[model samples]
Target: MKQLILAEKPSVAKDLSRVLGANQKHKNYYEGPKVIVTWALGHLLGLKMPEDLNKEWQTWKMETLPMIPKQIGIKPLPKTGHQLKAIKQLAQRKDVSEAVIATDAGREGELVARWILEWVRFDKPAKRLWISSQTDKAIKAGFANLQPAKAYDNLYQSAIARSKADWLVGLNVTRALTVKYQDNLSAGRVQTPTLALVRQQERKIETFRPQTYYVISLEVGEERGKRVQANPYEIKDQQTAQGIVQQLGNGRVDSIVEKAKTESAPLPYDLTEIQREANQRFNFSAKKTLSLVQSLYETHKIVTYPRTDSKYLTQDMKATMRERLQAVADFSPEVKTYIKNGAVVQQKAVFNDAKVSDHHALLPTEQKANYAKLTSDEQRIYNLIVSRFLMLFAAPHKKVQQKVTVKFGKEQFIFTQNKIVEAGWKTSEEQRASTIQWQEGMTVAPNFSIKKELTSPPKPLNEGTLLGKMEKFSLGTPATRAEIIEKLIKSELMERTPAGLQVSPKGKQLLELVNPSLVSPDLTEKWEKQLEAIAKGQFSSKAFLQQIEEDTKQLVKEVKQSEQKYQDFSLTQKKCPECGEFLREKNTRDGKIYVCSSAECSYRRRKDPKLSNHRCPQCHKKMEIIEGKNGAFFRCKFDGITEKLPTKNEKKKKMTKQEERRLMKKYSQEEPQESPLAAALKAAMEKQ
Candidate 1:
């Protein structure tokens, strides 16, 4: 009898099939004499939508909410209906004896496989094939030692509770706010609190007033300098700072305190830390980092799971650290050097069973990577994971930290120095030592100047800083935090600027209209804590869900009764021809656009010029297609050049950008051309 193996994605299924010797490949599954493997496209089914459960709850009406369902169930997702049907057929086949769940080893992955098994009515005994990495060794071992499906029942229960809770709270309150405000205002347990964080920063910046301050600086070296005062002076004390600078003369070191310090290497990456680092270094969005790392985990099969929250390894995993180091030794010279130094895992701080859950820290597989096949971004992400892994075995960074109190006239100035004792794990570049030196009771004269500064406002939340905040407040799980932040951006609640993420005009209004409790992180953090408790089997899923229902009721009621106004700053004078409704103006990356004010109407037009394929005669670049009272015509914005568009009967020459550039360069190089009349006159004058 064949064992049916189900995986989370096609790529993962292929990896499992190779190890299981499933040579026979079909459209949806791979078959061997003993086993058949199939995969789910992420999730084959999700919790049933309200519209699916009842027709009365379909329309967006305030009265229908809080549309709490008496019973929450699952339905096949529309896009993956075919895959779900295939899994059903395979499960029912007489040749198939037992099914093995090989989806991701997380709560969401458990839910993906369980929902399908329940929906398909697979009655055969089932086991779970859980492993962290997609490498061949991991797959082979996982298949050989399968766990009973019943073991993850609590985790599956937690997944259900979390999904249903989000549905109950997110859908009910979102509909209530949208219907009451007559605008597309999205609110949820996680996203609303996240948006509140952004608006909080924006408000802080708006009300903040800059204050002028002064400080005294003493130059010691050609380029090195030290601040003379421990605290900055107020604007009223500017003269006091200047007078102190003028009194600066001979300096005496009153004392010197030195302490030896050892710095251990950083812990392995959890998804949130890596995402934050990627955003800060590469300006990559949180979602972008997740996608890149996911490819490294799944497609390349070089890294362990990328969605883990733990930055530590269990006792069992310590034996494999050396092999993992060997796999990545070729990627960097430092890794080889580490191996040569006996590869001792000095920092025992990284190995703690209590700190690891769902999966151990993100780690490299025991297989070497083929760098040529990886994309540029993939290489970057791989380097980040590998570098962190190698550092775990590196020696502790040692240094001598010294503090010196320098006396300048009657005031005391502080100077500090950190001398590197051992360059372990860190380079001189990262751990720069102060070049300034002074001995006890030594005297030296230095030039001092008053430097003017100002008290700055709070910096805006970039993606990195925002992710850190989300983690601190337990806004969402590491896997879900990036998605929640992305949802805010896509919904037009926040925008990413060069400065950082700023709330849009509509987002500010939505924050004010939503329930105050909904905007605060405490509510979401409490829900997350209870969700974790449910996963640990300490709390009942039913009890947690019931709490969510009552909270939803309160949030919806507050939104319904809110007297706050929502002004459409985007309202336009022009009317939509399709629905006869006034258009609303919005600024997009392309430029300004006018969309129908009514939500039901899907009509929009670009207020700015749209580029056309008709190239300019001189630049050979595409011209803008402008709509006029008479008809449509092409206008070149660069040179203010206009050209008549060809009529229906007239044919215009069309060429690709490459062809246009090639032809323009080839012909335009022949030099200036004379008109026909001028050419004829020149020829006649030559004859005379």
Candidate 2:
């Protein structure tokens, strides 16, 4: 009898099958002399929806707002039922002796395999192959050193508790809000608090008024001389600022203080840090960054797992640092500096067993990337992970900081400069460091200038800053934070604007109507800490789930009892053709769409033009097909360039009646025999 291996996705199954010599391919699995490999399409089973538990919950009503079922069963996803059946068949095969969980090595990955094993009633012993990367060597090593599936039971339990908590709170309150408000509204433990953060910033911007202020600074020395900057203080009034600038004279150096400082290289990325960096550098959304890294990890096998919270590696990983660095050195030769004696330099900040759990920081695997095959985006993300890995072995940056204090009449100004000692991980900072000529009791001329400025309003939170806030509060795990932010946008409760993330009018109203506790991060933070405790087996899942149920019940009751009202600020003046009700404009990932305000009316259409394959010459993105006054044209939204679509058989433009009349009136002034142009125009007009 042969052992069976269950993988998370078909592509991964194929990889496992190839390495394990399971070459005999079947409709849903691959078989060999020793083992059989089958695959799951992401998740073949998910928790039952509220309606699936209770028939009464199918209808949206306040009476059934808190629908808590005794057993939240698992059901086959509608689209993946066939795959689930395939896995079941393989599990029961006579030739299969035991099973291996070869899915992703994470909390959710554990749930994916466990749900299937339990559902199929596979009685055989099971083992789990846990590896961070999908490289051939890693896969082989993982199979050789398999762990008992029982080792991950706590992780699976934690996944279940988290899932059920979200369902309990998300569903109960979402149903209550939608039914009470008479509109499709959404609220969640994570998304609601995130939306509130954005709204908080908006309120600050709205209430802020610019106030004029002045700053007094002095520029020492003249052009072509040893120029240094000395900033003294800020003045509230224009006259005061001018007086300070006008009374400036020769000054004597008061004192100087200098010290040596050093900064270690930044730690390698966890999932959130990389997402933040990609968002800031490429302007890519957090979701986009996650997907890119996921592809790099799964498809390319160039990076480790994409979802992690640790910024450190286990002590065991120290031995592999050289190999990881060597892989990265191929792309970035600068990494060569850190490799010596066939190993990377050891650093204390990088390896700590206590700091690593679940998985280590996102890292580049020993497998080198095939640069030609990677897209530009994939290359960018891979580089980020690799460069950070190289930085770990880099020496700490050392420098000496000097502070000079000068007394100019009644004012004292201080100047600081950095002198580079040894440029380590970051060379960019060294360029700003220079030796300033200053000492005690030295005399120098002082010149001052006053500048008027206005107090600026607070900047809105972008996806990067928003992710930072979410991470700070433990609002969601690295795996789910992007989805939470995306859900807010899809629900029409948040929008991405040039200024950054902003709450839409609908979102603002939803916040006012939602329970105040739901909008605060404190509640979610408490729940998240409890979830972490549950994962570690310190807190009982039953107890944590009980707390969640009680909290969810209270939140639903608060939403139902609130006297606040919700208005659909998204409604447009345009009326729907099918129903007399007004249509609402919704911003979707696919672009804007118009929908009938009346839910009963099934009328919807795309508001933006359909996209075509023809790329814009300027931006290289797919252009929209728009029907202009003459004919259809390809319009690039980013480039704002339009070009006419090529026609089948080139045809002359037909003269309009207005244009023909104007042309004939001007050219037909007893000049039918005057020129050939007049004759042509007369002939065209006659034909029309």
Candidate 3:
């Protein structure tokens, strides 16, 4: 009987098919005498929305929101319905005796396959073909020692819980906010926390006060007849600094304490760390770096998994170190020599099983990379991965760190120096050429310290350090972090300022309007802790999901009753000449025209300039073919001018500063009115 194997992606399925000798490829299945391989395009079936259960739920009404289904249902996307059909047919085939799950050996991967199985009514005994790499040896061994599918029940449970929880919170909160605000403002667990962070930074930057401080520098002369200028690291108050400078007068040699300290090499690169470094060095966005890494994995086949959190390898993978090292032998000669001379030392710090999860940090695979095939950006990324891989097996880079402290009465001044002691891993020609080193113990200054007073606000957030914080601290998974950042930007809740993502003025105002506890990282962290518990088989997925549904219900009720106002700062600009009210622009089949702000006024005018046939240079105001000193001059009502201007290669661009200020003012004055459902809910809330 044929054994069917299911994988996460088509690329992975192809890899498994090759290793299993299932070369006869059909529409969606690869067949051999003893094996048939197929794949799932990630998740084929997912939790259904409230609208799927009933059509009436589509509209954003308070009564219909906070939808919590009794039995969480799953439905296939129309685009992937064919894939589901294939899976069902494969499962029911009489020739198939048993099935094998060859998808990724992770929680999400397990969920993907399991969900499809349940949806297709697959009942055959299943085995798991878990392997980290796509190498022939790894695949062969994985099949040879396939494990029981029951082993990953806990992981599957955790995955389902995560999916359901996100669905519940995301849908309920998004619908509630949209209904309450009467706009398309959406919210999610991750999105809210992310929005809060940006808004907090913006508020801080807006309210930050700049202070002016003074510093005094002394130019001291050395014993070698050389004058060296040094600044005292200590920045004291202006009064004290002035007094100290007066005491020295011209130049005085202060005691110089120069001591040498050693510095060790940095740890190997993790996915997040690499992303951060690439962002800083190349100015590539986090999402862009991930996309490049995905290509390196799926297309080039030169790197391992790119979505991993682990920076170290497991002990079991140590045997394949030689092959992995050999893949980049030509690229890094120094690493080749070390592997050739002796088996590369397996440092526990770099190769510990406890730190490793389903996959290790991104490293070179056995596949030899064709550098010519890589784009300029890919080449840069691949080179970094190669260099980092080689650096791991090589010796640690050594350096000397120097710290000098000088005492001025009760206060002390400090200076630090980083001196390279030995370029161990960095000794290789390529590494040495690429690396930068500072000189050792060369006191080339005045050797005297000056007192200075300085004060500055917090620095802006960069993509690099922010990503590092997100990944290193388990703030969110790699997949979700990029999505959340994008959501914040799209929602106009967070804007890109000189310093990282700061909440837009409107974003801060919204936070104050919404429930205080709703927009917090604590919500995500709490859910994560529960998900982890479910993964460890210590908590129930059902219990966690129930909590989410109940909390969402209460949150919706609270928001529906609140008297706070929501202001959408998106507006138009046209003054009403009759009533002096700001004109709101509305689009009709005829064209764009201005209408009175008060809908009851019913005052409107034709805004089509083409109808008048004359374009004004000042404001594009159409004129009725007016005769002037220049024979035919266009008149502009807005600019109140009639002048000749160039028409070739000219376009009017909106001035953003004035537009934003105008919108903010308009929004601040007008408060949103609640929907009828919200009004009814408020009455019910009051009675309760």
Candidate 4:
């Protein structure tokens, strides 16, 4: 029987088709003598929304919130309904007795395929095609050793449990908070925790106390080179730094302790590691870098998977290394030259079969990349992956150490330097260009030594270093880390200052208003551990989900009981005319708006006035409905008035007949709140 192959994405489908002799391609379909392959557009099926559960839940009502259904339902989105139809049709084909799952070999990938099969009611026995890279050799080898689908039941279970739990907790809690707070606010278990992290950083910076620290440096001479300044770690206290410098008295030699140490070559670049380094060196946000890498992988087809977490390859990948390197080397001439030596560098750090999970670290696909077709950004990202791939097969960089000791006053000081012996495994030209070198067991003589005093505080956390911190805490996976950071900035929980991310006052207020446990990184780490356990079959998904449900309930109860007042950032003095309630103007993803104090009354006015033609006569511009402590009023166009008649701009210049007609036509076609740019600009100019 011909096998029906399901791939997670079009790119994977294309690669698999080429290797399976299924070169006869159709629109969204590929076929061969023995196999018919198709693909998934990420997810063709997803959990039903709150409105899908019941019509009553559509409106935001406090009584209708916390709508946890007995069983979460799944359905295809209307936009992609046909894709689901195609999948089901293929599943029931008479010639297709069994199927192969060639989706991404990860937790989410497992879920993607399983959900489709379940939805289509496919009862046929199934096989799995698990391979990290999409090279012809890897695909052939995977086909040669296909495993029964039953082998990954635990993985599917874990994925399902995660989806169900998210549905139960995220939807229910998000609805509950929106209704209870009488605002359009929403939250999820993962999202809330992520927000809390950003808010915490903001709080730290806002309340930070700057204290001067110290660092000691010296103008030291190399044996054969001129003098240069060396930078070392800072000492926090000025007093302590001064004492150390004074102890040095006149120039004196310091003792150096130098020992030979070999750093194993770094494992191949995983998505997270690459994102971190890119963020550090290029000042690229994690999200931007991921986008760039994704473009190279999908559009240019130069790099391997960009969403992978693994940093090492399985044993089977070794056979295909030469071909993969050849393709990358061809695009980057430097890489091509290194591999021409006919020597492959193999290090445990880069190719530990034991450490590899579903997918390996990102690498170049065996398909040669067409450099001229790539954009400059794509080339930069592609080059990064290419250089990283070439370095894996070069020798480990070796270095020598030198040490010298000198006594200055009661304190005995020491100095050391390192010299590179060889740049192994990373001998490519790019590698050499990026590498930093130092000599070991080396120190300056008395005449060359000088005492310097320094003081500085700890450096603020930047995107690069903060990413490293998040990695250590296992805050989120490589695929999700960038998104978390992006959300924080977009939501205004954290602001990027000159130094680094600073928590905003609004962020601090949110933490105080919500449960502390909801925002803790420990919660995320604990959940990740449990998810991994579920994936491994070591833990039960049911039990894990039960824990999430319990956590959600506790969080809701705490928020309800807490009496702490939220510091409303939109501190306006205007009152609502409808109910004489306090008016609050708030910013949203799109723009800002004014809402009434009563949560039950969904009275909201958009900040944009282009949609509405209403205008303030005083300013002769559209006036947005704003709430403050003052009584309900349409503030003046040029100056705000309390519950009084509208006014116009004092500086309003006389308009020509044509201008007047154009203005009239524009107002007739719009709403007072729909034209934000015009209203805001006119308001500012009129005020001046």
lDDT per residue for candidate 3 within 351-410, as digits (tens), equals 787787567877888877898899999988988988877766766666555444433333
Query: What is the TM-score of each predicted model, taking all chains together?
Result: 0.88, 0.85, 0.75, 0.75
Kindly list the per-residue Cα lDDT of model 2 for residues 55-74, writing each as its tens digit: 89889989987988899989
lDDT computed for candidate 4:
0.71
Kindly report the root-mean-square deviation of model 3 from the true structure over all alpha carbons.
18.6
**True-structure Cα RMSD, model 4:** 12.5
The 10 consecutive residues of candidate 1 with the worst lDDT sum are 222-231
Clashes of each: 0, 0, 9, 70
Which pairs clash (backbone N, Cα, C closer than 3 Å) in model 2? none
lDDT (Cα, 0-100) at 658 in candidate 4: 89
- Residue-level error in angstroms, candidate 2, position 647: 21
Please say which candidate is ahead in lDDT: 1 or 2.
Answer: 1
- Model 4 bad stretches (over 4 Å): 10-33, 54-68, 213-258, 330-341, 423-463, 487-506, 570-688
Error of 4 at 132 (Å): 2.1
lDDT of 2 at 128: 93
Candidates' RMSD to native? 8.1, 11.4, 18.6, 12.5
Error of 4 at 150 (Å): 1.7
